[model samples]
Target: MKTPQIVELTSTDIDQYIDKLCTILHANVHDGASVNFIVPFSFDDAKNYWKNKIQSSIEKQERTLWAAFEGDNLAGSVQLDYSMPPNQNHRCEVSKLIVHPDFRRRGIARKLMAQIEDKARELKRQLITLDTVKGSKAEPLYLSLGFEIAGILPGFSRHPIENRFDATTYMYKNLAAKFDG
Candidate 1:
């Protein structure tokens, strides 16, 4: 696949690409990605998630979403949420880094992450935190990108398709370290 062009998605863009975004989310969840969804996840469920949950956050400026596109096709997306408690203004959380299964191994997730990290730095956020299913493919990616494991929440969530529990690995990167010197 050609390299995807990454763009910060506005609420209007979300509305325009709503179906594609929903498709990406639905595909990932059905493929066993622990992305806050389970099997029997329908297209309507995905649509509601992006429209109700994510779109509102974007409109409120509490979160920023980025999408990776290969031509007109939506390859993947990631979100950086800066809406924290008053005392935690310098931190942001990375959530829902989803790539269409067909677009995996193309560095799309890494690109999405780089975009969000840059956005965080631009907004003066010092700490970036995220979590993924322990031992999943994403764990190694986060590590390679300089995120250190903060802790592991054993059985924190269930496997998307199975009835068994899965552990979650919380990881963080201190962007302030890069700016300190």
Candidate 2:
């Protein structure tokens, strides 16, 4: 299958992104994946969250939101936040990476990550960090992509349905040396 093409998501893209995020969140809960909420996530809440995220990103002017689309359908997404404190402005944080249930294992997330890295480099960011639920299938992917496990935080989150899940892995990579323009 052809991977979805990544595009920079602006405020105009919030509605579509929210729809996709709701799908992923519902699926994760259905699959018993420990993200948050339960199997029946409220689409309204998801929409509200994405709306805030988009507005915040725009206001901060230090974040980049990228969405992967197959034709007119959203397939996945990843966000890069570049608003570190003064001394840490060279670092970025990766967050809200989600792929549709039917779109897993086809490198969509990898492509998103790569695109975000390119954006980070373009902004002169020197490091990237993110937290993923422990035992997630994404752990291997991150490690394979050269992200080092900074550490693991235990009992970091509790799935409203899954009851309790242990740990969230923190990963980061130095992107400065890898920059090529």
Candidate 3:
């Protein structure tokens, strides 16, 4: 299948995309996807969280949010945040690389990742760092994309309903060299 296109999330797209994202998050919360917030979170709460995300992205020095599209549907989303202080100007953090369950294994997440990496390079960010829930399907994908495992945080996350689970695997990708090109 041809790859879905990745585009910057616009003001109009944020609300609808967040709605779909909340749907995906709701499903995952039931099955346990260590994002943020405990399970049993309402869609309203998710919308509020994403609302802030959109605002933060609009800040010139904060973040850039990207949404993946398959035709007219919102397939997935990701973010590249550069809110580091003066000393850490060269670094950025990636977060919320999520795809709908029906859209998994279709290269949507990779495309989104690529989009953010491109933007990071344009923004002169040399290092990109992020963490994924341990044992999640995305971890291997990240490893394949050249991200190195920096460390693991044990019991760093707890599902309000799942009792307890391993924290997350912190990973870093040296994009400075790649950014130079």
Candidate 4:
């Protein structure tokens, strides 16, 4: 997938979002993403995950899902989670950034993150937080995108494939004035 078209989706786009998200989640987990799932990743597992977790969340206005398409195929997606405590209304979590294994290294993730940042700023979410497997490829990507590493939690999760415990890096970016020039 080359320069896939990225668009923000809502509950109205539930079916398409579920289909694309299922594929992306399965591909990422199968490719060793170490996200919330263990090995034996299956398409049904991915499909149900989105149908259950994401569909309701989007309906509740707690998350914004963005989908990327490569010639009518759902290639990737990233989500912004606003389901935070009332006190932290100015912040949100960036989670579930995934790209199909076949669509890796095509700048889709970068574009998704950029659009997410734009969305956060638009919503006046001054602070954005996210965590990824420490020392994973995504760590550097977050760093390069101006997210500051707050800390790392050791043995945060176990690799679904390698079976080794890995740390998780906590990152934060203050977008209060970013791109407001």
Give stretches of model 1 more than 4 Å off.
178-181
Query: What clash pairs does model 1 have?
Result: none
Q: Which lDDT tens digits does candidate 2 get at residues 1-181?
A: 7758899977665654667766665665566665545546677766666777554775568677888888866788778888788978878999777787778888899999999889988987888999888888889989999899999999988764665766999999888766443
Q: Is candidate 3 or candidate 4 better by lDDT?
A: 4
Q: Which residue pairs of candidate 4 clash?
A: none
- Best candidate per lDDT, number? 1
Superposed Cα deviation of residue 64, candidate 1 (Å):
0.5
What is the alpha-carbon lDDT of model 3 when measured against the actual structure? 0.78
Instruction: Flag clash pairs in model 3.
Output: none
In model 2, the worst 10-residue window by lDDT is 31-40
Error of 4 at 18 (Å): 2.9
- Tens digit per residue, CA lDDT, model 3, 31-125: 56667778668888777777766555655547778877788667778888888989888989998787877788898888888888899889978
lDDT, candidate 2, at 38: 58
**Cα lDDT computed for each candidate against the true fold:** 0.94, 0.78, 0.78, 0.87
The candidate, 1 or 4, that scores higher on TM-score is: 1
Measured by TM-score, how close is model 3 to the native structure?
0.88
Instruction: Give candidate 1's error at residue 129 in angstroms.
Output: 0.3
Candidate 1 on 1-181: residue-level lDDT in tens? 6889999999888889999999999999989999989889999999899999999999999999999999989999999999999988989999999999999999999999999999999989999999999999999999999999999999999899999999999999999956452
TM-score of each: 0.97, 0.87, 0.88, 0.93
